[model samples]
Target: MIPWDLIKGGMRHHISEHMIICRPVSENTYFVLRLTLSYLSTQLTWEEM
Candidate 1:
């Protein structure tokens, strides 16, 4: 969970680093990343908890 928060916070940094390295990424990979990030970004309300 700690690592996940770090990645979420440094999203732009990671994107820039990836671009600098010019690594090829698949669409499926990005989709999964966005999906997980979105899912994690939700705030849990007391009622939900």
Candidate 2:
């Protein structure tokens, strides 16, 4: 299982960085972003464990 605290901090940093690079996202882009984030979170959690 992943630790909540670590995910929150790291996720925030990643999101901020992403926002800086891509400020305007369309519907398809949003869907892709969601999928990417989900994949990233799962990978990060696994790596943490």
Candidate 3:
């Protein structure tokens, strides 16, 4: 799982709601990251089972 603290720390240093929404590329990257994390967690769960 991606740590909220790490995400928040990165955001604190170099991102904002405005920047995230304003840039198309950044928005895509964010979505990809979300999807990848979700997929990874699901796979991990299946492996445990």
Candidate 4:
């Protein structure tokens, strides 16, 4: 029989691992979106000038 504590610990570890993997991806996506938005804004301003 499996122990409840072991199952809980494994689930917790899995969740933490997923967060570790996803954290960088989400951060990179945010960074890219910010850069793209800034670039687009600059282009629009230049066209207006």
* Clashing residue pairs in candidate 4 (N, C-alpha, C atoms within 3 angstroms): none
User: How many pairs of residues collide in each model?
Assistant: 0, 0, 0, 0
Which stretches of candidate 1 lie above 4 Å from their native place?
A: 1-25, 43-49
lDDT agreement with native, every candidate: 0.70, 0.84, 0.83, 0.87
Candidate 3: Cα lDDT at 32: 89
lDDT of 4 by residue, 8-45 (tens): 99999987687568787886777789999999999999
What are the RMSD figures for all models against the true structure?
7.8, 10.3, 6.9, 12.0
Residue range 1-49, candidate 2, lDDT tens digits: 8899999999988887776677746645786889999999999999999
**39 Cα displacement, candidate 1 (Å):** 0.3
Best by lDDT: 4
Please give the lDDT score for candidate 1.
0.70
Q: Write the per-residue lDDT of candidate 3 for residues 1-49, one digit (tens) a residue.
A: 9799998988776756655667968777887899999999999999999
TM-score of each: 0.36, 0.46, 0.54, 0.55
> Model 4 residue 12 lDDT?
90
Better of 1 and 3 by lDDT: 3
Q: State residue 29's C-alpha deviation in candidate 2, in Å.
A: 0.5
Q: Write the per-residue lDDT of candidate 1 for residues 1-49, one digit (tens) a residue.
A: 3798788769978776775577546645776798887777654443377
lDDT (C-alpha) at residue 31 in model 4: 72
By TM-score, the candidates rank as 4, 3, 2, 1
Model 4 residue 31 CA deviation in Å:
0.3
TM-score preference between candidates 1 and 3, better one: 3
Q: Choose the strongest candidate by TM-score.
A: 4
